[model samples]
Target: MTSPAEHPSAESPAPVRWGILATGDIAHSFARDLALVDGAVLHAVGSRSLPPARAFAEQYADEKASPVPYGSYAELLADGDVDVVYVATPHGRHTEDVLACFEAGKAVLCEKALTLDAPSARLLVDEARRRGLFFAEAMWMRTNPNIRRLRAMAADGACGTVTHVRADLGFVAPRDKARLWDPALGASALLDVGIYPLTFAYLILGRPVEVRAVATLSDLGVDLAGGATLRFDGGAIASISWTQTGWPDTRASVAGDGGRLELPSPFHHPQSFTYARNWEADEIAEPLIGAGYAHEIIEVGRCLREGLTESPLLPLDETVDILAIMDEIREQVGATTG
Candidate 1:
């Protein structure tokens, strides 16, 4: 059987121990998916307090291993067995937490939108580069099998000079969820949901020469809903939208002179994609592991086994570039720091 990257020796390395910081909802999902990764162990978990940390560890414990629960992030970072740390904190706390991981000489897989601003994201990237540590933005979509196939097909001209793309994601977010509306939490539909569609477009068309965007800001100054029109080379354009206001179809499609492809609702984690050319159409299904989060965990494990500092599939520079684009979009929409 062919290895994922063919970089590691014929013999597999020891299991990669993952240390998770913050027992938030995202961390729960990541931990559960760790079970699906062939060579990964949930060695440790940390939270602000011992109770929640212990609870999370108990819930995800398996016959093979039970993750050590730490009451503080520093305690987890200090653990010698932790090969890497997954920072699941909110956008605002990412920089501080990730930098702490680096200080402890631990590798890191930080959540998407690496930081609230471009400069901070760059700082983290520079630190990882300088330290020669493994680091990646956990933009899980980019690691999806179907999305990877789509990107490859588009690049190979399966869609023939792709000229336009359309994608939107939205839902009526509950006001009680402070993270969805609180600017202090780095809350914004654009940051939370818009990044998916925007990254999808970027994977296909690369960087755009011009981006014209506008948004409807919440009373608190975060963007509740917005849209952006990006113009890429050869005049390819992508129309993207997101909202915390109401339900949207959440569908995405890409068009080219030769054909077009459509992804179902919640396209970011789509189960399949359909491509139509002339009189024929084909729907492609790519099997997903666990809750579809396994792919990323597997990628991280592969990188560690290979002793690589970053993933080739989702480079650090790409993460910084995407964050820079969001920074510009936020500025154009007049989003506040909150």
Candidate 2:
């Protein structure tokens, strides 16, 4: 299996004990990434169901590593062995699950959008602050090296004076009772997948001053597909769209006064980005050792060792800000949470 970039001269390496808070596909992917980092261990797994939890532990744990499986999330939180918890439930469940973890006095890395709305997100941030525990939204793409490099280049004027951004993320899926299509599951293009491209813009340009959105509502009254535009303070604008009804182009581009950069694949896990200026072009790629999540796991470990509660790279404030933007977009487009 692929592993993290080794640090040969390092001494006294400490292992990060992880307690996974869900057993879904994303949770499994994260668990796989965690196992690739040298100083990381899967200490426990939790699910609303017991069988899946045990299966997860068996699949990720080493032969001598006996990771516990908890039927309920509370039991996992109560375990003194777990140093941190990674919450991977659906978007709506994030508010309650994260709050519960904070109440348990455990450090948390909750999934993106942070919560269903701004108010719920505020509660998590306040709770984490009150308990003095580390908390962050799992905006995994923000911590990606290639993405960081791209942002740095943009900041340094390599992409010129950023004038506009366009991005999209979509995948075709059936409209069954699956979480991605169910209104009861809080499924919508914006939250379920739109956040990827939306976040790309947010990471590069910060929050917009004005937001406008429109969507094609599904039979369940959820957004089947939608497009949104954000206008920033400096005349910069971002156009973003997402859909479950159709396959997305899955690409992103940023245009500036001098040049433009384009990613051929998903902006979130981009393999290559092309830099073009004056009719000339060059490509840059940063390959992952495992799945792209290893870097984020490494990041969390670094922050913990350095005694930091939040990472400057992916701050808690940014999480709350993005959720607020999402909430407003939903309201403007007539996508109600209830």
Candidate 3:
């Protein structure tokens, strides 16, 4: 496992300039949220072609002094002004895309399931460390203010000796979307939505001792959905599920002998969490700062300015560990990450 902290915290005079690596849905969301951060700039955007990149830049023009558009990803990385990059490429391309960012001597905030597999994830982490560049897995859920508080509460014994954890995330994914259903593109339900519930469990209970899983595979051999039961020390367990075929409660809970805290529907980015103690449940609200993506963007800017190679909130080791567990789960269920 890699050590957590790599650099001392400090301040910088200039704001962090951001380059967006792809123009996907999440890319749009990140670009929009960049406007909410105090000292962040949407410096540029890149795509395989010039047209979409141009349109994206024009769309988010007000976010910064109109981000410069590039026809190729290499052009975006080559920009001398781009201090850090937000990689919004597909899972299958994450390893390649993030490596380019590191090679370009730029810090990176890559999308979740950092790579198609754990080993590939380590490659990126190792490369980033070798280059002394800041790197983070863009698991935005880990940075949500309310989610942060919930994790702290669990650590502080709010969920006394947490014995059981439950979380589920699912949606009716469209078959027409190639990225969601294509195996070569790293389309696995476990990588897509399953990771959310899996990470939710890991955040509360450290690493588990064993993970038993079952998956429903698409005709293409990609996982469409799955269920996992992870057993931890002291008989604690986490039950999580994900799907791209049906609707689920999409809620999450951490329960123990003392009490439990439950996140509302769409728990990944829940509006709030409810803490129940002594038979009474109280709702705790922590309003998000602009579509909930701003928090991660804010953390990235702060880490760059502080000269850190890794984020404490979403450590690279933890990201690798989570993907490793998912690897086991994927195998047990006879699915591939493409």
lDDT of 1 by residue, 1-338 (tens): 11123323327666778899999889999988997787788999999999999999999999756999999999998887788889999888999999999898888899877888889999999999998888999999988898888778888888898999998998999878888888998898888889988998898889989999999997889999999999998999999999999899999988999998888888988888998899999999899887778898888877877778899987999888998899899999998754
For model 2, residues 1-338, the per-residue Cα lDDT tens digits are 00122211135454777899998878988988887887778889999888999988889878535689999898998987787889998887998899888777788888776777788888889888887778888888988878887888888898789999999999886656477777777877788788898899997899999999988887777877889999998999999999888887889988899898887777888766899999899998877657688888888878776667788977888888888888888888788564
Q: Candidate 3's residue-wise lDDT over 107-193, tens digit each?
A: 889998799999999999899888788899999999999999998998899978899999999999987889899898999988989
Candidate 3 Cα deviation (angstroms), residue 295: 0.5
Residue pairs in collision within model 1: none
lDDT of each: 0.87, 0.82, 0.88
Q: Indicate the residue-level lDDT of 311 in model 3.
A: 93
* Candidate 1 lDDT for residue 73: 95
Candidate 1 residue-wise lDDT at 6: 32
User: Which stretches of candidate 3 lie above 4 Å from their native place?
Assistant: 1-13
Error of 1 at 1 (Å): 35
By TM-score, the better pick of 1 and 2 is: 1
- Predicted structure 1: clash tally: 0
